[model samples]
Target chain A: MSILFDIAITAFLIISGVFGLVGSYGLIKLPDPMSRLHAPTKATTLGVGGVLIASMLHAIAVEGQVSLHELLITLFLLITAPITANFIAKAHLHRHVERDQLPDAAPDDCWAVHDIEPFQAGAEPSTETTK
Target chain B: MIEYAIYFAFGCFSLGLLMNLWQIVFASGVGDRVLALDTMVINMIALLVLFGLMAGTEMFFEAAMIIAMLGFVSTVAYARFMLRGNIIE
Candidate 1:
């Protein structure tokens, strides 16, 4: 039974890793930066997080011990991936793409103003930034 | 079984590293590259967890905690720069 459980967990990790691979492929093949962000950010985060969980489960299952280290790492990855992605996207927009160059879509709808509310004043801008 | 799982972990880590390397070399935008860097950091965390399993010790967890915190703070820092062009170092 324990061996069966081990096999199941290993299978789970591999499948999830395949998903991560697909996401990374999307990263390489995608045409635009924004679109590239979409694949890895959403899929890879979940993919890597899934495998991490599997690793944690496998350890606990084999040793009859619980580990919180992987769990905490997963939580941090989930929380941080979006943030770094957001920074990079915004930087690309500001540095390379022009506002006038942007599609005439309602800019407000295009940019999700979460951290600093672009164009707003005194919004307690995020403190964790570096270029 | 764990051996097979370790193999899978190696595959995932290698795949992730390759993708990140591609981004570093070929990606066109700063944001995309930065996102790739974060992904790399996550991969490193995954590697550490695997090491914990191999060693049968919980110390790797501490390293994960510190790295996670670093990832978080760096994301915040990058975000700050993106928004305002300055970070409150």
Candidate 2:
């Protein structure tokens, strides 16, 4: 279509592609699983958003109609990524990560997955509510 | 020019996909592999959308959406299994 439209689409595509590559690189290169979690959840989400927006713009320019499906996919992805990250992090905390490595929580505020009783504490707050 | 840019972007995504696959194969822990798989799924979505743009077809968009849904579901399932040692329980 128009040069400006072409440039915009190209820009979106390239920027997204770069982010995708960087996220994947971080996923592979990061030393810790916790650190790796940061890569795809944030960067890759934005990358896919960019590509989807570019697709929407292209569809609108070429077919003269709005493409709403991409928006749905974007919404679904945005909603799910964090949930998935949370579950995975919880799983890691339960099965792999050391308890000492975790941020100190009040004894009553224990994570639900941990299944430990709210430990009695004299000094620290009882944040361990899960057990 | 736009066509060339699309090709370059595709190349970048492909490289990223390959990297993710490598990590998935060699990752030390299940969680690491799962995380890599999640990243791979995202990269795949981006690649599929780029393909749809290049080909001027919307069909790949449907595939991308389906993959996005399935990937998240599977990740959640895996995480639950890891946490509780089972999916449903």
Candidate 3:
């Protein structure tokens, strides 16, 4: 039983480590700010979340007491990552992208960042090409 | 064995921190730097949690939670400043 618990913790730690490395590599290798945004938001969120879970498990195993505090960190991270990504994306669109490159929005709609929504409802997704 | 796993996680997170630092330094736009900073804070929180486990301590969990809040606030402020040239306005 103890062996199985150890295995679970180890597995989660390894998985978290791998995702964290991939996220970092993606941040460095990906081209353009918009493309790079995908790396840290998605991968790091998973990586950190995994690590936090492993921590919770370890505490329970070692202390024999349910350690629920780690869950608060995980919850806080889960809530904030997407908001951070959205704000950073909006900032990127407002300051760096060209007008024509941005998609058209409804005539009356106004984006708070730059008065322009960068994505159109029907616009094709940007090609995934690593640089 | 668990100790070894914790050490491995430490190395991975350290590498991530370095990458974020590089991005913050070489980024072409303010948004990239802001995002990198945000990611760095997350990595730090993960590292703190792992360290807490390795040391068999509970104090780090509170620290990690506080850092999470600080990181989010800073990320929002940076993004807002970039977008409007004024965070409060």
**lDDT of all the models against the reference?**
0.71, 0.83, 0.85
TM-scores for all predictions: 0.77, 0.88, 0.89
Q: What order do you get sorting by TM-score, best first?
A: 3, 2, 1
Worst 10 residues of 3 chain B by lDDT: B80-89
lDDT of 3 by residue, A39-92 (tens): 988999899988988987887788788888978888888898889999889888
Question: For candidate 1 chain A, which ten residues in a row score worst on lDDT?
Answer: A111-120
Candidate ranking under DockQ, highest first, comes to 3, 2, 1
DockQ, all models: 0.57, 0.59, 0.63
Candidate 1 scores a chain A TM-score of 0.72
Per-candidate alpha-carbon RMSD to the true structure: 5.6, 5.8, 8.6
TM-score of model 1 relative to the true fold? 0.77
Instruction: Please give the lDDT score at residue B2 for candidate 2.
Output: 67
lDDT of 1 by residue, A43-72 (tens): 777776767777678767877787676776
- What TM-score does candidate 2 get on C-alpha atoms? 0.88
Worst 10 residues of 1 chain B by lDDT: B80-89
CAPRI band of model 2? medium
Q: How many pairs of residues collide in model 3?
A: 0
Best by DockQ: 3
Clashing pairs in 1: A88-B31, A128-B76, A128-B77, A129-B76, A129-B77, A129-B80, A130-B77
Greater TM-score among 2 and 3 belongs to: 3
lDDT of 2 by residue, A42-94 (tens): 98998889888888888877788998989998999999999989988887888
